[model samples]
Target chain A: MNNLVEIVNLTKKYGSNVAVNNLTVSLPKGKIIGLLGPNGSGKTTLIKMLNGLLTPTEGTIMIDGNYVGPATKSKVAYLPDRTYLTMNQTIREILDYFQDFYADFSRERAEEMLKSLGIDPSVKMRTLSKGTKEKVQLILVMSRDASLYILDEPIAGVDPAARDYILRTIINNYNPEATVLISTHLIEDVEQVLDEVIFMRYGQLVLYTSVDNIREEKGKSVDAYFREVFAC
Target chain B: MLGKLMKYEWKNTWKAGMLMLLGIFIVTVAGCIVLQMPGGVVSNLVDGNEANAAQTWLVISSFTATLILYVIMLLASTWGMLIFLGIRFYRSMYTDEGYLSHTLPVTANQLFLSKVLVSGVWYLFIMIGIGISIVALLVSLMMGLMDISELSGVLTQYNGNVWEFLGDGIYELNRVYEEQMGMNLLHYGITLLLTYVAGPFITMITLFGALTIGQLSSKHKGLIGILAYAGLTILSSIIGSTVQSVFMFSTNIVSSAGGTGITTNWAYDINVLTSALVAAIMYGVSYYIMNRKLNLD
Candidate 1:
């Protein structure tokens, strides 16, 4: 598998504190990679840097052989932890926005998902429940047949049912050649779907291996291994 | 992509823009209607007549109310246009929506330019709308103050050659400007108009630059942005005054020479050139910050 993302000595600092400290990592295509970390471990920062929302204080990030920029943005589909959609916009208008901006955006797929979820296209974002809004955002993000999908805590605040649906939607919609990087602290919930797991601790990559290897080598699930590795 | 960005920008802002314009229109029309009301105008000749006191009082009260409403609407429209544009730019580019905005497949320059262009267009539109409304109100007021027959008598002098009459008036005005300022009034007028149009762009871009600078802070970004705005405003003011004085001094020398003709009209020319340069600098700073140092939280 070709490298979909490459980061070299990436360091993001706030004042005297480092958020992502001299971290180097790479993600290859055709995989569901879990970017697992506890709270304040820089998972969101790394995802934001990949999407070009935050500039790295030092070092560089390359996405698909190009520097993080508009070109990379075109290929990378990002779901920030916050609700980035405008509250004033209708679901259909938001869909149109995605269609207009992303060349790979699939309106048909988005409409099908909305139909399955029983979401009205004309409803404004403010009228939707928090769970529904997350579902809509996830639908829009997944609707794009992007080269890389970067999801930041997609199931953090949602109920278990919604989490299951989100994970299912993510697994069902992604292209085989594309890579999915999901960042979350809920190790057990997403452990079943992850092919490879990268554990981050205090802005550092502590472990990078397949879930099968962790289970085979330690005779424990990835979640249990995570508990042992990152135990305070 | 810039075009598409501008299209979306216009879509986002047009609702509020149109509402402001509509507010101005409604206020102006109401003013006009009030002026045309029976006994709405004050008459100097009828002022001291005891029998007409009630009528005069009613007319004076009507005029006062209409004037107050018109003034409020005027202030609202002007400030509303600018404030609404600023809010749109800040919310769309700096708030949580910024996650989507900055992640779009568009360059920083493209985003900045699209915003500037859309803002400029809206400013111009609102200005034109306000101007038309003011003119209509004035016409209505004139109709209320003067007799229609007398007004028609004055209009008969134009004899359906209003354009030629206006041209002659303009030529005379140009001759006067040529004598006093060594420049054509038409050229000076164009420069003044350009200066006016450049104002909103400079203001908007400066705010953008300030917001970008503010984003560098982890907390109280809005406060930082406000401070940056205050600092930039003062800096620009000092720079503008210096440039103006320098141009005024040099242009005095040319004015004394009396040889450069239209080109020597340094007053409006300096204003236009200096304004364009300032706006360009603001745009440059905004583009740099947006491209290199964007730190949306």
Candidate 2:
């Protein structure tokens, strides 16, 4: 299988401190990969660089065989860690905006998801709770038929039940030919849904292997292996 | 793509912009109505020379209040457009919303051009709206101040078209200025018009540049942006004044040394050229920062 994302000598520095230091990794297509790391382990920075929000200080990120720019942006669906939607806009307006901007976005799928979630399309974003807002953002990202989905902390800072809904939405909505890169620290919650895992520790990728391989080799859940590897 | 971007930009800013415009219209209309009634009474009393002190005071106060309201509305209509557009740019491009804005499938140049075009259109709209409101207010005041006989006489003298009367008045003034100061008032009028139209574009782009500079720093960015703008303004003003003085001095020396045919229109030409030059520099700097050094935090 060809890789959907390739990072070559990627090093992002703030001033003196390196956020992502000379990291190299490639993510194959058509799998849900969990990017597991603790806080400040450079997960978000890597995702931002892939999405072209932050220019790489040292190297290049290729998405779907194209360098990160407007072309790559069209193929990558990104869900940032925060609520980036305008507070005054309604759910319907945001969906319309996504549909207008992203040619791969499916308004029908978004509406169906909103209906399944029992979310009011006319409700303003500011009136929604933080968890609901996060869910809305996830639904929008998942409705896109892009080549890659890069979601940053999609399951963090929400209730366990909301987290389950988000995971289910991701599982149901992603296309079979596309890849989804989800960044989060809740390994146990996401392990069952992920086919592969990539672990980063202190701005370096420490592990990248299939979940089945890890389970077969270690005789334990991927979460247990994560706990063992990241233990201080 | 630029059109679509501007459509959404208009969607986000139209509420505030329209409300400000509506406020100007309402204030102008209300002032005109109040002035028409009170102004007639006050002028009639004064013309008859029969009003007591109390009545005079009441008329004066009423007229003054209406005048103040008209002035305030006029000022608000003009300044509010620029302020509102600037706020829209800052909020949409720099705040948390920037995450989506920058990630959209559009290049930075397209985004910048869309914003500049939208802002420019809205500025022109506000200027024209204000111009119409002022004309309406003046017409009302004229109607209120003139007695029936004087109004008829003036109406007949101007062939019943106030615009023609105003045009003739301007023509006379232009001729007087031409005779006295060797300045073609028509040329001055054209220069002023061009400057007025170009000034807002330059100002908006300069603000964008300062905002971009401020974004380079992570702390106290707003204050830094304001200070940067102030510094730019002061530096440009000093340079402009120095150039103007040098031009003036040289022109005076040459004219006194017997260059009679050479007109002082060079001064205004240079003035307009200098403004266009500054605007171009500001636009270039703004485009550079937006395209290359966009630090949207």
Candidate 3:
């Protein structure tokens, strides 16, 4: 259970172009881990495999000691990079849906977050601004008392101020015993809050170490080092 | 979980269906009523004056236009319902909305069954709506041609024993048709009804299976899905025709080269069996794609 996510030799290919190569890694519990990578580096692909969105071409992903099935899905809260909700449905309906399916979903927590943002639960998703919709999606994801939170580009769509609020929500609201796996290209903004970083390059793991170690041992911030290594 | 999925599935799909059904009811009633107007006008033609003739022509022209519109509305809405359901499945299970649906704590079978069952139920409701509309149309047409008293007497003769009345009605119908042919009309009707009810389920499976196949493509997935569906339908029709021809040639069911061809019920039964088997296979294929071969971008 300490290793919340165990991906073993996972590979996802589209016709012969490998998206996620034979990548294997173990993520520990109770830490905010930044899955940092450049564009097309397979960060979202790997996150998708863990959330059961894409079936891996090979290998396995075990979350909370369960294979990526319904049992594992109940423990993983996934926020995809796009708006996955229907435009016609009200936020209240989606909340009911989540509460019905995921035992870990908390309606009160989600409602509280919505109230804080001055968003009416009765408002249809179509009526919300893109940034507000992303915030709502983040709210729904963070409201779940899940064992693993897999968020893909969670802050990419929001404004700078809302990004800070969303980052705070992610850092403060998640289960202390759970792990949060965030995939994003904006490493500098997230490096401060990350307990650890898993830097990926070309669908291969480049580094997996603590943020303190990156700053202390490498004598550079994660942002400064990332810019140096991934500079085009 | 399947029930919960179906609840939302029903909610998401029912609004357009309700509106379509209401439109069908309104159009059928109004069309039938207006169709009675031309007959009423003719019956009241006293001396065929110039104004009366012009009015009659106007009425006839309007009636013809209304008839065309009614037919078009019925046919378009029926086809529209199927297309809407297919789009629903594609959007919720294949497009951006799939991110929410796939990540839920539910199995692939649950998702597939929810869409199939909901779409099937909608088809059944629509068939019933169409059936009721047809009955209304026939009743109005009959009323226009016959006296109200005569129609009331006919209704009274049945004494509200609907089962007996239906039985007698079918018996009379077959007794008349049996003079020239020797096929069971009830059996043929039952087969048709089965196809009417079950056809949409097969179509639903084909659509979902095709969309699932569309996932294999890098782009133009929805269009590719439509092409796949067209391919499946063409393939099914070929299979249906082949099976039908085989039954015809093997059994030698025709009376003569042109007299009373296909009088037996074997062809309809085989058609149902073929559709059922194809749907089962496609259902299995769609489930497999959703389960293992899913490649959402």
Task: Point out where model 3 deviates above 4 Å.
Answer: B38-59, B147-169, B176-179, B253-263
lDDT of 1 by residue, A1-232 (tens): 3798899999998888788999998899999999998888988888988999888999999999999999999999999999999999999999999999999999999999999999999999999999999999999999999999999999989999999999999999998899999998888999999999999878888889999999999999989998998889
Better of 1 and 2 by DockQ: 1
Q: Model 1, residue A25: what's the lDDT? A: 86
Using DockQ as the measure, what is the rank order of every candidate, best first? Answer: 1, 3, 2
**DockQ for model 3?**
0.87
Worst 10 residues of 2 chain A by lDDT: A51-60
DockQ, 0 to 1 scale, candidate 2: 0.63
For candidate 3, what is the DockQ-based docking class? high
| Candidate 3 residue A46 C-alpha distance from true site, Å | 0.6
Q: Which lDDT value does model 3 have at A125?
A: 93
| Candidate 3: Cα lDDT at A230 | 83
Lowest-lDDT window of 10 residues in candidate 2 chain B? B258-267
State residue A31's C-alpha deviation in candidate 1, in Å: 1.1
lDDT for residue B229 in candidate 1, whole number 0-100: 80
List pairs with backbone clashes in candidate 3: none
**Backbone clashes per model, in order?**
0, 0, 0
The best candidate by lDDT is: 1
